[model samples]
Target: MTDQHAPVVVAARRTWIGTVGRGHHERTETDLAAAVLAATACDLRGLGNDTPTDDVVLGSCTGPGGNVARAAALAAGLGVGVPGLTVDRQCGSGLAAVIAAAQQVRAGDARLVLAGGTESASRAPQRAHRAPHGLTPYARAAFTPAPWADPDMGAAADALARRRGITRERQDAYAVRSHTLARAAHAAGRFGPESVPVGDRLDRDERARRLDPDVVGRLRAAFTPDGTVTAATASPVSDGAAVVAVVPESVRRDLRVPGLRVVATASVGCDPALPGWGPVPATRAVLDRAGWSVADLRAVEIVEAFAAQVLAMTDALGLDPLGGDERVCADGGALALGHPWGATGAVSVVRLFSRLVRAGAPAGARGLATAAVGGGTGVAALVEVVR
Candidate 1:
């Protein structure tokens, strides 16, 4: 009963994620995004379709001000006919872009699209407004207006951990598990198929193993005074890009390629003060729309913005396999892979593609990807394997 005209993600790829100021320091968002775009385009063609892409939809946060999607599209040699759009939903930006592209394909407005996200935190220093007296700098952008409180992600995570009763030891244990899984994946070459080398240099993550419990145990709180949340529990500010080719199901049929079929997507709003809870509602909505429950999902990916936040989500969602859930982040998550804010959501999708599609899961096998945004929003997509 699969819809042949529905949009399917046939190819997914990402550049090696790096710590903000170290590996990709000299590369802009455009440079990193363009590399993956080009690689993903090759994937599209290799699947036996050279039809020019209809559009480029990308998401970014704190990138070089202008329209980075358009710039990256041209830089990737997509030609002048293809237009581009950029979306920003804070940390949810990347998944939002993919959902936007799927909407276009569903409406028959476009046949094929490239969608994902990119971020260059190192290159994007704090921006300032042109004041009459001089320049006024702000630490971060405002997500809410008066009356409502919008604390930084670090502080919010600490508060959320305490409110949710997530112990610091549990968070530290999860952190170690993430690194352990990621290292196992890397040693087995699990990342090579989906990861592209950046700048012909080290194409690996820079900050994970430093989180030794003895070491992490001694580290002080990063945001709140006397808080349990520490550097070891939070994802680092990182830089990277990821892209996927979303094509009509007819294309997948024609190419004889197995891919993830876009089934349903949901976005929900929550209290700005507790943005991490956004995923709880968003995931529920998407699953309801798809007529599928957690028990039916073969794989799930949730951005690991913080160990406490991720644990809260898993607990709320009733997913019981907490210690080593192969169904959840079998390879790793942002904790070990590095969360390039805007790009991490798409990276989630890419990981699902690798886990389900590339691994040859049975037809109709389902997977999910979700992310919690800083602006009190959550986005989730339900996809199925079509063989």
Candidate 2:
């Protein structure tokens, strides 16, 4: 028999709602934060609710001093007393924030919360810092890897591609599919309602358009000397933000909003040397916790950190690389949408929500979302389509 007192709260309603960023160019960290907050506020208004949010969680991999979340909360018009937390788990930061928010809700810590992630790769470059001389000798020694090991994601991606037997042709094919799906979604106006357009100041949503065919050919190999991965095949360094509002099932029913539910979430760490494989263990952990199998999932959104990483994950999961059994990144992924580091994971969730709603899957149908991060850490979340 089921435990009647078990936490039965659902996700309520999660809307991609709004996104804002500069065109495919550099944007200020403050601007990105403000844009994200503004978009979130607009989305809240659309929900037609004035209830005070219990908490705010923001994800960001890079930003001005790593304070994007706090700044965003303030800019979004939340009260000064409203608690806010910023999370950074590399590429999975945003998704991690969402998972954390959901966990808090399930544990009865809060009845309602706002969760999302943002990134400004163009404005916030990868950072390297020196440890203070006050540290112990051993501490300093251990910190050596911090500076030297900060390799470009492209280089890491190239290495993984070659090691994992991913070929140039396969990468190109995936790129083509990503663009095709993104173009289709845009043309069909599927992403229109969710995308909050930036104003004349920004002129365009930096990552909201299709890739250029000519640019695809002109791209040079990235990372290794003869690496197959190119800028075209890899996700662009761009800026963007996404947010979701989570509430209790009772509140959902009262409000009459149909949404998704968080079933399980897991974060796992692996050897930093094999960063690309982090998702394998994370996936296993979530599935184990939920007692579900890959066969039970109707859709999956594995962050495309690189073509090779996606290829490796699919192979590890025993999924057909070319089959359509699971709608994997049915819309273009980071490769096409741009990887805003901390925002990518949350963005993946938004995509998952959009895809599930469109497919009209039955209640209890599962969706798996995963993202690989630096230092061999990955996060995965299992969500159910709530009836």
Best by lDDT: 1
Q: Highest TM-score, which number?
A: 1
Instruction: List model 1 lDDT by residue over 1-387, tens digit each.
Output: 667679899999998999978989899999999999999998887878876799999999988678999999999999998889999998999999999999988888888999999999989967788999999998778988878979788888888888889888888888887888888888888888999887766657666554567887787888999677887778989999999999888777888889999999999998889888889999999999989999899999999999888888888887744655678888889999899988999999999999998888999999999999996889999999998
Clashes of 2: 0
All models: lDDT? Answer: 0.89, 0.69
List TM-scores for all candidates, in order.
Answer: 0.98, 0.84
Q: For candidate 2, lDDT tens digit of each residue in 106-164?
A: 77787677787776555654444547764332211121175445445677677778778
lDDT of 1 at 19: 91
Model 2 alpha-carbon miss at residue 120, Å: 1.7
lDDT of 2: 0.69
- Which window of ten consecutive residues has the lowest lDDT sum in model 2? 135-144
Off by over 4 Å in 1: none
RMSD in order of candidates: 1.2, 4.8
Check candidate 2 and list the clashing pairs. Answer: none
Off by over 4 Å in 2: 1-50, 125-150, 201-219
For candidate 2, report its TM-score: 0.84
